[model samples]
Target: MPDFDFTALRRFPDVEADNLFAYDASDHLILDEAADDLHAAAPGEVVVIGDRYGALTLGALALHDAADIRTHQDSYTGELALQNNAAATGVTGFRSLDLGEELLTGSRVVLMQMPKSLSELDEVAETIARFADPSVTVFAGGRLKHMSIAMNEVLGRHFGDVRASLGRQKSRVIRARDPRPSAESAWPQRAYLDELGLWVVAHGAAFAGPKLDLGTRELLRHLDEMNPDARTAVDLGCGTGLLATALARTRPELAVLATDTSAAAVASTRATAEANEVAITVRRDDGLSQQPDACADLVLLNPPFHTGSTVHAGVALRLFEEAARVLKPGGELWTVYNSHLTYRPALYRIVGGTRQVSRTPKFTVTVSTAR
Candidate 1:
C-alpha cells in the first residue's frame, strides 16, 4: 500500500470550523484495518458507505490503487465535500451512489463509518446482507465514545460472525462476516401521527423517524395562525415533511416546498407527502439556498442545533440566515427551538422583529417577520 496523507482533505461546501473536521481517526482506523482486503479485492468489489468526506473512498484509491469504488453518503453536504476534496487532491476512481443494491451489489470488502442511529446501521447492514456477495467482509468503524455494544448486536443480526478490534487512537472497528440475508428491508418506516392527522414517513437516517418531535409539534400548533394571506410557504430543513404536508393538506391553495440536506430526509419527506396525498415540492438542498430571494411568504423551521454528533449552534444560525434570505418583506419565519438556545436575539437580528408565539418549559416557539 502507498502512503496517503488524509490531512489534505477539506470539508468544502459544508460548515467548517476549528472544531469540526472532514476526516477523523475512525476513517484512518477503518482503512488500516481493511488494508489487506482492500489491496487484494478486485476493481468495483470495494464499497464505502457513510464516508463523511472522501477519506474512505479517496484513501482506498490513493493507498491501495482501488478502482471503480462505489460510495454512498447520506448527507448532500458530505457528498459535495467528498467531490470537492477529490477534485482538490486529484484523487479519482469512485462514484457516489444512493444507498441500495447498486451501491451494495458486489463481492469482497466494505468500509463503513458507523452511523449514530442504530436504525441507520440496521438498514445498511440488511442491505449489505441482501445485496453484497455472501463472502463479503465489512469493516465498520467509529469513535469509541460514540460506539456501543448495541452496534455489534445490529451487525450480528445480519452477519453470522461479528467481532470488534482493539481500540486505536480512540477509535474502533467492528468486522462482520458470514452474511445472513433477510428478505425484508426495515427502512422508510411509517406511522400515523394522531395529533397532526398525518402519516409520517422516515428512512433510517431521517431525524426523529416516523414520529412527531416535540419541537415540530409545537410549531405545527401555530400552522393555522401563520399569515392567513400567505400563498407560498417553505419548510426549511424539512425532516419528515410534516410541516409541508400539513400546510398543503390544510390549505390546498398554498404552494408548499420542503427542503432538507440529508438524502434520507428528502426521501422520507417525499414519502410522507405521497403517503399523506398532499402536493408538496420536496428538494434535497442546503437550507433554502436553492430558493429565490424574497420568494416565500412564510417559512417554517425546526432547525437542528447539532451538526452530526457535535452540539453546535452554527447550523441553526446558518439556517436562520437562509430563511431570512428567502423570505420577502412582511414574510414570517416561524421557528421552534430549545429554550436554552436563546435564539431570540439572533432571530431578531437576522430576520427581523421577533415575537414569542408560545413557550413550553423546554421549548420555545417564535415568529419573526422578515424586514
Candidate 2:
C-alpha cells in the first residue's frame, strides 16, 4: 500500500487558520490499524465514524483501496470538507450518513476518531453495539492528551474487551471487539430549564450539553423585548434550540429557523423543538452561507469561540458576517458572548450599529442592527 496524500485535504467552510490544522497523526494511526480489519470485512461493510475532514475515510479509500466505505461526520463543515476532498482527489463510492442505523448497520469493522466527550463515545459505543454486526471490531484513535481512563470504561460498557495500541507520535489507538449487544443508550438526553420554562434535548455531542450556558441564559432575559412585527427569525449557531424554542413560545406567530454546523446539534435542536411542542426549521449548515441575502428579519447568536480544541475568534467572526448578510436592513442581530472577548467593535464594523443590551460579570448581550 502507498502512503496517503495529506495535501489533498482542506478544511474550507470550517475555520482555516494558521494555528488550527486539518488532519492529525491520530488519523493515520487509526487507518493503519484498521487496514487488516478492512481487508477482512466485505466492501461496503466498513463504517467510519467521527472522521474529521476525510482523513480516516479518504485515507482508507485512497491508500488501502477500500471501496463502498460508509461514514458519519458530526460537523457540517467536516462533511463538506470530505466532499470537497473527494471531488479534488477523484475518489467516489463512499456514503455519508447521520449517526444512526443507516451508517452502522451490519458493519464488521469501524474506524473512529475518538471524540473529546466521553458521553459522545458512549453514544457511538451503544449505537454500534445495538446496530452493527455482533462481531464488529472498532478501532478508535485519539491524541494521548485527549484520551482518558473514562473512555476505556465507556467502551468497556458496550464492548466485551478493550485494549490500547502503542502510542506513536503522541497518538494512540484503542481496539475493541465482542460488542455487548444489549447495552442501553444514554443519548438524546432531556432536561428541563425551569428558569426559561422550556425543555431541551441534547445528543451527547451537542455543545454545552443539555443545560443553558450562562451567555444564552443572559440572552434569553430579553426575549420579550424583541420587535413585535418580526415575522422571521434565526437562531444562528443554535445549540439544542433553546433560544429558538424560547422565541417560539414567546411569540407564537414568528417563523424561527434553528441552524448549527454540528449534525448532533441539528438533531438535538429538532428533538428539543419537538419536546417543547414548538415548530421551527432545524438544519446543519456552514454558518449562514447557504441563506439568501436579507432573508431574515432577526438573527440570534451565541457564537462559539473554539473550532475543535483550539480557541480562535475566526469562527465567531465568520458567523457574524453571515448574520449580517442574512438580516434585512433595520433588522437586528442579538448576540451573547463572553465579556472578556469584547466583540462590540467587530459587531459594529461587520454588522452595523451595536449597542449593549445587557451585561453581567461573565457575559455581555448586544444587539446589532443590519445597516
> Best TM-score goes to which candidate?
1
lDDT tens string, model 1, 321-370? 99999999999999999998889999999999999999878999999999
Please list the residue runs of candidate 2 whose C-alpha ends up more than 4 Å from where it truly belongs after superposition. none
- Model 1: residues with Cα > 4 Å off, grouped in runs: none
Give the per-residue lDDT digits (tens) of candidate 2, residues 1-371: 66667876788868887777779999989988888877677788889999889988888887776779999999888999999988988877698898889998889989999998887888888899989988899999999998898989999999999999999999999999998975456788999988888888999898889999887888888898776679999999898889999998898999999999889899999999999898999888989877899999889999988888778999899999999999999999999999899799999999999999888789999999899
Task: State the local distance difference test value for candidate 1.
Answer: 0.91
Error of 1 at 20 (Å): 1.2
Model 1, TM vs. native: 0.97
Best model per lDDT = 1
Q: Against the correct fold, how does model 2 do in TM-score? A: 0.97
